[model samples]
Target: MLNPVMNNTKWYELRLQMCALVPPPTWSTFSTAGYRSQPDREWFYHFREGGYEDILHVDIQVETPVEREIVRSALKAVHVPGEETPSGFRVFGYLHDGQGAGYI
Candidate 1:
């Protein structure tokens, strides 16, 4: 998706679409949380030069292969402008298929 960090409006809209297209686990939670402040490293969270508050961690859960494809398509369609993210946000997905299709 458009490096949601690039635009607030786009991010908001995309976030809504993602939630609608791919629902997360009911038991899980949504957050903009990340390790931008931590010394460790991770790809699930998009870390930028900005502060941690700028990050948005939208970890979603897809229930089916079709849903997974849609989510993946949506991610591939967006064109993120500039090398640096305006804010500090990223999208993630977890497929609960038997194969253990973890994070995306």
Candidate 2:
């Protein structure tokens, strides 16, 4: 299970993709570059498939309008699972209105 020469993760290799309504404007021209530079690791949380399935809580607080829009526009809805919110996806490309599509 431990390959010293390759530390790549299962999720990163899969590179799941999702469609967003649109991206702000920095996703392609800027944020894309930043997101690619992460430590090449996967972040995950355990979910309870039983009683508290809908008990998840997320708090978002952004002070800047520009930054706020980027985070807000990331999610489509709670129905789509991974693509439910901005935190759900990664910067993939730009859309018709300079917005972006998020990939997992």
lDDT of 1 by residue, 4-95 (tens): 33355544444444545424221122334433333222222332224223443443344556655675565445542212112222353222
Residues 7-70, model 2: lDDT tens digits: 1232222222112222222221112123222221222211111212122222222335664555
| Cα-based lDDT at residue 48, candidate 1 | 25
List the candidates' TM-scores in order.
0.37, 0.24
Clashes per candidate (backbone, < 3 Å): 1, 3
Q: State candidate 1's TM-score.
A: 0.37
RMSD each, Å: 13.0, 16.7
How big is the positional error of residue 42 in model 2, measured in Å on the Cα after superposition?
A: 10
Model 2: colliding residue pairs:
23-99, 23-100, 75-85
lDDT of 2 at 52: 21
